[model samples]
Target: MDNDEPLESKTTEETETQPAPQSSDEMLYCEAEVPTPVDKEKAGRENSETDLEIEDTEKLFTTGQKELYTEACKLMGVVPVSCFLRNMEESYMNLNHHGLGPHGTKAIAIALVSNTTVISLEVADNCIMEEGTLSLVEMLQENYYLQELNISDNALGLEGAKIISEFLQRNSSSLFNLQLSGNNFKDDSAELLCQALSANYRIKEIDLSHNQFSDKGGELLGHMLALNVGLLSLDLSWNHLCSQAAMALSNGLKANITLKTLDLSMNGFGNEGAAALAEVLRLNSCLASLDISSNDISTEGVSKISKGLEFNESLKVLKLFLNPISIDGATLLILSIKKNPKSKMENLDISNVMVSEQFVKTLDGVYAVHPQLDVVYKSIQGLSVKKTILQWTNPMKLIQSYADQKEITILDFFKSLSATGAMKMSAGEFWKAMTKQNQVPLNRSQLRELTKRLEDSTGMVDFSVLSVAKP
Candidate 1:
């Protein structure tokens, strides 16, 4: 004790002079230095930075977005919905079949005014009228992020179309695809739209199908097509376009430089229209796909169209099916395609068109020049092309038998597959239903070929067509 303790021991007098021993906490407090002005400022700044980081990381909608949504809800007399706000974060917002009336549509449009994320907006079958359309037009003026807009099957009449056309004339640079199909647009609306489209150079695709656009409207669109340089695809199918209208559109093709696809199906593009298209095809080489199916194009029309095929080297897909083309006309078509050594044609759909044995032989010879060319036909005379057609008739017959045994019409049979009671069902779903449980004895490729015949451009099979179809 004397050796170890004497070296470190302090005198009693010195310890008393220093002060009483203190605890660790008391020592720390006595020795701690007070923060200076600079130190306090540094700590404040760090706390502020942390708050900002949390705010940015936790916030889902920006201030502008929140303001827009609040305003929309106020105008609609509804409370703000969290789900709707969540959709603001998505790139695509589909509100199809939501029964969003004029007010609802206008509200949604307002909410989208400040959106920076949404690029594709689908508001189809929403009962949108002039008011709703005007709101959208205004929103589009401020919102440039949206590039694709689908407002199909709305009641946007002439006034609505006029509003849209005006907006397009001024602000169409942001849009690449526009769908206005199934609207009640007439000739006047068509004229207005055509004028706007002529001025626009950014839109790549436009759908004006299933409207009331007649010859007068068609003629205006034709002139627009001639002037437009940015449009790559145009759909005028299921409209009231007639022979003169077809001729006008064909003339438009002569001057078009960017258009690659043109759909004039289910119109009355008769022989005169065919002749005009034929002449245009010979001159223009930009178009790659042309659909004139069910356009009332007859033997003479096919004959005239064949002449165009003789010289065409850019057309890859030609759909002349469902037309009243005769064996002689089809034979002439095959001959024209054969003569064109520079032809780049890949698909020739002459379905529902019967051909003679001689035409089949000639078609076989055409394959020598274009071995990759695929021809879709109904049947051949005195010979079977089952290998080529994938046994189209056999599948149809099997479907017909199933429908008969079920004691339901063919249309009903297809309709049964649709869960929504709609007149249409998906091609893939229909294929699965037909092939499921050995209902339709066919492989995947065979079913696909048959389904292609039954499906429309949307890849949906229309059961209504089955009512009048010949088994």
Candidate 2:
């Protein structure tokens, strides 16, 4: 959760031809993955779990369910990522309870078997079980085309994990970007995958977060990683990987040369574990990004990591958020980064590091001097929907937040609405009034829903929703 891929836009043209992979050993790394819960999206939008809308030009057939799969393949070739094949504006593929039994997996399997152009696929959150995954495995066994496969949030249980791991050990699958996050990959089954990982370097990027990978699983991962040569990015966050696992992974990094990004956030890697990992940063030159955020790393660990940074030449992003690294620790770390003239650091996230206001102000001055080294040192907290609405609805508050010089007030806002000379109005009327001559964030129906929420009895304006003070 520290950093993520760029957001996808639906308006972007889908017909734009995507260049095919150069290597016969097609790489499977891309920006699409398992689906996560988003806001109920815009109010105007219908239920966001509808089927994908294929373009007229991309349709190859219009038969039964088979055509849907064929059309999916036709549209998918436009982008390397199958997830991006979706129209960003439309509702996403949300098949929680409706896994379609065996038919859903067969549809995708048929598409994969027939199409050789498609590379990346994101079929996560479908609650797919052994049958669906086994169906995919069967197709992938003969497939040299599939590079990326995201089957996260499915029911790929212990047996399934063992099955996939054993399959990978045979070098039959060519998947490069494989994400198995949120599947119950427990210790014994996880170890099977780790054993396979020792020999299989075909996978370049993998996400095994939010599973049951603990210190015991970490030991297996560490032993394999020491000999791993092809893996560039690894995400092991939120798996309860404690200090012992951190130390083991750190030991693996000492001899690792291919790993560039490692996310150890949301784990329990304390200072003792971080101190062990610090040595790799000192010796390894290939690592480009490291996320130790949400760990209880204090000054002692920061001091050691800073020493490693002195010798690091390729490290870029260092996320140390949610730690106990107070002002003194941050100051020492910042000074160490300054000493590394060869450091290609683009951003450092030290947010919620228990720093004082004065220390943050000083860090801001440093950030101003070295704009390339952007420092994020803020606390991230959640807000209620009602509170968010109240603040956003206030015209003066919104204008001030945007830093616009146009002096608009609550009175002016009401007067502008009154220009139409109607005290009571429908959401449709309010939508037109609010979106006059400019693009508002809300859709047409969203504007109407907001009007409904704020209007009082007899459809009179609440006025209170728009009464927040400008910052």
| Candidate achieving the largest TM-score | 1
The TM-score of predicted model 2 comes to 0.61
lDDT of each: 0.73, 0.64
RMSD of 1: 22.4
The sequence of per-residue lDDT tens digits that candidate 1 reaches over residues 29-114 is 11122124312321122232231111233232544565465444333433333334557789988777655666556667767765
Residue lDDT tens for model 2, 67-163: 4553343333311223322322222332233232333454456455545666776677766577567667767876687788888888687877876
Off by over 4 Å in 2: 1-98, 354-371, 379-471
Each prediction's number of clashing residue pairs? 0, 0
User: Residue pairs in steric clash, candidate 2?
Assistant: none
Q: Each model's TM-score, in the order given? A: 0.68, 0.61
